[model samples]
Target: MRIRTRLLLLSLAVLLPAIVAAALGIGFVYAEERGINQRNLQETSRAMALAVDRELGTREILLKALASAPSLARGDLATFHEHARVIAEEREASILLSDENGRVLLNSRLPVGTALPALLPTAVQERRDAGPDVTIVSNLYRLPRNPDVPPSFALQVPVPHTARPHLYLAMTTPASQLQALFEQQRLPSDWHATIVDRQGVVVARSSDPAKFVGTHVRPELQDSMAAGEGMHPGMTLAGVASTAFFSRVPRSNWSFLVSVPDAELRRTGLWASALLGGMSLLLLALATLAALAVARRTAQPMEDLRHDAQQLGDGAPVQARSSGLLEVDAVNEALVGASERLRRASADLEHRVAEAVASFEQSQRALLQAQKLEALGRLTGGIAHDFNNVLQTLTTGLHAARLGSDDKVRRLLATCERAVTRGSELARQLMVFGRVQEVRVETFDLAQRLREVQPLLTGALPTDITFTQDVTPGLWPVTADPLQLELALLNLVMNARDAMPHGGRLRLRAGNSVGQSPAQDLPPGDYVAISLQDEGEGMNEEVLARALDPFFTTKSVGRGSGLGLPQAYGFARQSGGALVLRSQVGEGTTVTLVLPRAQVAPQEPAPAAPSGGLRGAGCVLLVEDDPLVRDTVRSGLEVSGFEVQTANDADEALRMLAGGHCVDVVLTDVVMPGSMNGVDLARLLAREHPRLRVVIATGYSDRSIDMPGVRTLAKPYALHQAVAALNEAMAG
Candidate 1:
């Protein structure tokens, strides 16, 4: 409130905050300089290490590729010169090959007859003894024929020589090559590098090392060599606190030590800190001026807004000259417009809300219609399944009737039978298209099963066509509906073969592919992929896009079914997978069947032979709610000579079993009777008569059955097919 006090407070606010910022800024600069120096040192060291590692890694790959040369694999030297020269050029290292006894067979630089050093390194010797490879560092300085460059180091990569029992691959890189590498790297000013031998002799030095080549560290520190205690900061040169670091050269016992001087680190850090401090003060002055200007400018607009708000609260009209500031003018204009709009919009919102409510009701009705359509699709699927069962029954009885008739009548009936069979197949395909058929799981090794189907795959192709199998090894086991998988593959392979009437390469490849993310056009997961590629007439992009839709095909009608891909698509969907098509107009088409990798594998095959006499003569209880189905099954059993009793559902079947009646088998349908289905009835009957065989029959083959011991049969069964199941049921 007082002028003196206000001045004091303002001074404190300005200078106090300024001083705090300066102190923090200066401290951070010092910390940052130290961090930068350390980072530079670490990064330089890592770069050097990585450089060495890169050379080593590249050398290893070069050595391996050289060892696998045509001359090496075939063991003939007539073509060896070009191969050896090519390897030398690629690796940038001289290559020398020798017999197990160290007699030089081939050298990149010298003639073929040149002799090598007699004493081979232990690494090379042992490698020659081992089966695959002999890789190690050997001091090549002792070898006379070794290059005249300084003390040399060589990597002896020995692999089996084709012509002889013991042969080797010696890849030599001169020590000077590495020293030159160390020499060329520009380290900090006053920073030097040294590489010492195992005996502490300085083998390589960046600076003039004539004075200290063979010198040893202090004996006290030398005693801790095994424990690595010679790495502390110590006096190496005047005024330089040299920090020593060490690492043993990989694949060797020799240790390498590098000394980084603290004076060099501190010299850069201190200078940087001073420079940073000067900059901090200058920035603080500028920032203080900017902050003051911003605060004054911000407060002016807020002050005007506050005055307007007060007048508006008191119900007074505001009149002021428009500021030249565009933002300020815009804010004032917005406030005026908002006030007027609020009054008018309040009355208008009710009418708009009523319109919105009507729109919402219309949208709700459309959604209901869509939901009903979806529900109708589901209902049609259920009815189609029951109708399919009736069709199967009609076909089965016709076949049985034809079997008992004369040969000429049988032939005529066969023509009608073909029509019926085709219709049944069409119905089955349609049901799949409509999403009625679900998954029916049978345990089989997918890779082996695919291999077995190779014959069928090629059979569809022309005689000149060549089909190749590109199955990846270590293919994981898969659990899925085997029948559906076969059908899907059948469709793809048949399509591929049909495309190439003149015969081209038809490849069926299976492997693990990481599926793309949904955002990337394919859904993400590990997929077991079976790709069928044909070097044939590929589809255009327009046709390919709609390839999986029902009745979308390029083939001439009557020659092919348009449902091949659609059926495959349905099968893939039912089996928790997807069917994808990729094609180029002139290039080949590839059909990829991607199934999710199964976590639970298929069951192993039974070790023992399955028991014979699956048939048994016993009083059997057949539970069928459908009278026609019951009568047909009873007639088939009467011909097969097994006494049969009847029931309508699970409860009736259970009642008869519990009534102390003699019954050996409880045959029932799964989706039937009371609260208890056939699965539940079977479970109860299993415990009731542990010896009685329980058989479950279903019209819905794709329906899942989780009960352990029930033998499942899909209907409209023939007398023989039903007999086989009954025999297996009656056996137990």
Candidate 2:
């Protein structure tokens, strides 16, 4: 409709065809280059094939001439041997003469009386089967007397006598001769030459002859060779997948293969095309840019309006400007009005975005808190696993010391035993905090379990503090992991003791509660409330509000891990219960655990086995990656009258077993070095030696527990526990 618009459209219409023509020209040039390269490769392959054919033909002629020597026709054997030796020395090949029955009369490589190998007779028979005067080129083989030499082929010809050919003459040439033929050709370094006999075994390769010669050609090449000489893409004998041009050797079943890697073949054509295409593209871009510039200059009125409209769309202030044309002036005025309205709308949107951002930040803070707790739980689990193994060694060693001790020594060992027991309890508490320990819930009397834990509680309290317990008679039984509940109670007691550095009263009380109003956010149900109250320095409202947060401790750094209260809270919530705390500074702190009461009565505890008389038998194979843990456990097992052998990891353990070491039980750590870890080792042993028993000992709970059908001994186990586990495995 407009002159400027029509000019812009006309320029693009002319430029588009030019760009297409340039692309077509580039593609044609590339195709022509590829065709030339393919022909060159075929010619090179044919020349290499001709070279190999000439080498074989020359060897055949030399063998025929040796058969016609004058000394051999007479009865003078020494003269014939001397003539053969001279011919063999000149050709640098092994020459042999065999009787019609295939016994060697003379061999250039070996002594005069040495017997010829079966290969010579086979070649003679093949020649006879093919009719008269046909030369046979045998497959590659090693010389009979000199096996150390490279692989060689036999060129066999029957000596023509008045009698029916009593003697057969053969010339042996090593594949190195063929290698020389390939080397003489002037070809590209990237091209590889391979010559294969009719059997598809490589007689020579130009690239790394020692590595590829005597190997069979790749199956793809074998298939292609059957159809005669041609160019095909296949894997080479060097194991590189490539394109090959092959030619059949003249007058022979052998083949000559020339290979060029696909990348190398395409490199030259692509480089030439890339140079030409880049120049063409640069010129085309320049032409298009020039055309657009001229068109924009001719259409100044429309260009000014378009620029103002773009500024309005991007929410930037648009100046009140217009082209002198009547239609563009009217459009500019409308855009100015639209721009004002958009500015107001954008302001309103900004106000709402501020409020949304504030809400999002609050949600992010809460999410970050949960993630922090989860990360701490993982850290605690890993630490507890390693700590448990250390304590296991300490526990076992202390028990061994206590066994043969004097009265004074016995008292010291007792103290050491108490400390080891405390260390093990600490590791278990860390596992609970980490949420790594699997919970086993059973109906249990709450009061009785707390009473059993009281002695440990009292031992942890200060001498000036007084401890008291009051449980309502016939308290309601709660269904939970008793061990976890006991640990939670101990945590609360320890907090109360720390509150009262000076003398104070610590009381444990349990009662039945039936309403939801008492504890905020607790479900309405019948519950047993176990409370620990201390008359000690306590928390204010501010400190108490953030008390349950993980790593939020008022105590000085290094004095507290800040995980105690959160651990108790996690345990209570996971057991379908709630933890509540109420306190005021300088008055006291009272922490209560409110658990839903079980509907049924509690089950009685199982009778304990007599651990004192427990002894392990049968030879035990101990596998632990840690040297200290392994050595300590081995000493303990020996003291317990069990035979023990040790390995650092599963691989060494397997080596020992394979070396014929006898063992009835395999005690292996779950994680070890090598491709096979303890779990993998157990599975292999299960199939290979069904009679052998496996005891998987692990300090880590996560991966170890997931393995099915294997007995796991959690570390640091006392020596007796390990022995008990082994005995159980042996018994099963």
> In TM-score terms, which candidate is top?
2
Give the candidate number with the greatest lDDT.
2
lDDT tens digits, residue span 1-732, model 1: 533344445655767776787777767777788777666665555455455556566677777677778776775654675677777767566787776666667777665555645445554455555544447655334354644444555666666445555667767765545556476686655775655544555555556554544455545334434443245467553335676555455543344455688776677667876787777667767766666566666557656766766665554555453777787677777666655655566569878999986885565545544533443343454444445445544544443443343643343344334435445554554443334676778756778877755644554455577878888886766668766776677667667866887878888888886654312344697778888888888988788878886655576533454667887888777767777788997798988877777877778855432110123466778887755456555644654567989998888877877788798777787655366878888888777777778888777766887665678877666656666777776653
TM-scores of the models, in the order given: 0.29, 0.45
| Tens-digit per-residue lDDT, 680-725, candidate 2 | 9999888888888899987775663443345888876877888899
Off by over 4 Å in 1: 1-36, 85-93, 99-103, 120-134, 139-149, 160-166, 179-185, 194-232, 235-241, 245-258, 272-732
Q: Ten-residue segment with the worst summed lDDT in candidate 2?
A: 605-614
| Count: clashes, candidate 1 | 1
> What's the number of clashes in each of the models?
1, 2
Candidate 2 yields a Cα-based lDDT of 0.77
